[model samples]
Target: MNQFVRIQYVFIVALFAVVVAVSGCRSSTKTYSPEDVVHYDESYDASDKKKIVRDLVDPLVQDTFPLARQTEKPILVVYGISNRTSEHISTDGITDDIRMELLKSGKYSFVNETQRANIEKELNYQYSGNVDPSTRLQKAKQLGAEYMLTGTLRSIEKKQPRQVRLQKKTLKYYSLNIELTNIETSLIEWADKVEIVRESSKPFIGW
Candidate 1:
């Protein structure tokens, strides 16, 4: 009888422990869904800018360069792209996208800023030593680039309130200008401008 009672007690304890362990292991995971509404008044989509630069600006510049008889493997000099806007925009990203496309087209070569700086430093160091003066000038001429490319980005914003509701609309207009200048002749061989606009609507959600 005592043996049977002991077995029953052990079984009951084991069953209780199992129940506690199973309940302790219970857990749930949740995933959040993005809001269906859009917010913010001013935002520039970087991806869109990259796509536009590659698709529109690169071909135009390539065509212009070929027309100018600058068929040689011209080394690219990135002059400047001024951002005349209120927002902090990375004009370099856009220029880089265009540069990559230009490189893939195999029509030109680029002198990156770092490479140019290193070349200049080495040239200076060589000239400072016992190297002949004529040899320095010859090397400089050999590495001299044929042309420079430059551009600017400008933005114009206009905001208007809707007539029927408490909502406002913002229009952002961006103008991109590019120019190719001949380094030997100091002449602008080609120039072009492209403009794009994006609009966003803001609703008065009580936040």
Candidate 2:
């Protein structure tokens, strides 16, 4: 009986050791803040978005643009920023940042085009007499935006030729051009461009 008990204890100890080894071998993840500029490959990163916003917003609010010419805050509708690049990028992030910056400047007011359908639904409900007449919103009284803010993002990528180089190099150029256009006149009142160039390299041989 003593010999049998010693064998059981040895088996349990070995199993526990195996479990510990497997757990130690499992991969671990590191967390990063959203504001940190981390680059794992040759792609658009947080730094690019930050720089683009910085470069573009200042120009739009400068004296050369319509900011100085107009005293009243302009109502704006952000149509969208079209993505012409090959990669899958959420272009809304770019436009949203720009919109936030403009809002902070207190020179522009925005119409929420994305929520127009829901907005209409609420208005229709209110008009159906379910709510008090004094508290209900009127139909067809919504303010029209005077100008539209939109633009395009484009990228050009170049790679090293198929030579026997020790490392492969890729160069990417990105450009973002934004414009504020008058809805009535169809003329561009303000425009600015942000350009970024990035290069990345990878070793040819595998370890």
Candidate 3:
């Protein structure tokens, strides 16, 4: 009887522990907004950078076609932006932000460069023996981009030696340059740049 009672007690304790653990885990889980700024630092932040780039590119593209040509949105493909900065910055993220902004502005249509392989595979499958010929899409009917959008992100860092001991300062200048070029004419239609500067200083004092 004692052994059976001990087993029942152990089972009850384990069930209670599991319930408490689950409740604790559920309470610890959190959801954060993309626009939320938790903390600021000297280094570049992804969310902050996205916002800045979006603001910089929105107006430039909004007026690209003018008021009359707004209806005739041009097709654009993101050729890609190179990250020439010292740190590991997400050029893809910046490109995505710019694309989203342009999309929201309804100024241009975008081609998915990252999904080219998948798109081709799907097209191939549709052309295979499985899919119905009547429903299959025509070959070479895909819309080609009229313009290519590309850019580069570069940073210049400067460090100054202090005249006195235990004093130093560093300045980082970040620049994002974006250009849109006509594929057929080989002419740049639009070009713009955005800059951000961050400065860090250390004093001869304790924190």
Residues 72-137, candidate 2: write the lDDT tens digits: 888999999999998998889988998899888877788898899999999989988799999997
TM-score, structure 3 vs. true: 0.74
Q: Each candidate's lDDT (Cα)?
A: 0.72, 0.87, 0.79
Model 3 local distance difference test score: 0.79
lDDT ranking from best candidate downward: 2, 3, 1
Clashing pairs in 2: none
Name the runs in model 3 displaced over 4 angstroms.
1-33, 36-39, 61-68, 162-167, 202-207
The lDDT, on a scale of 0 to 1, for candidate 1 is 0.72
lDDT digits (tens) for residues 43-89 of candidate 3? 66876576667766766565554521667788889988999999998
Instruction: Give me the runs in candidate 2 sitting further than 4 Å from their true place.
Output: 1-36
Clashing pairs in 1: none
Better of 1 and 3 by lDDT: 3
Instruction: State the displacement of the C-alpha of residue 180, model 2, in Å, after optimal TM-score superposition.
Output: 1.0
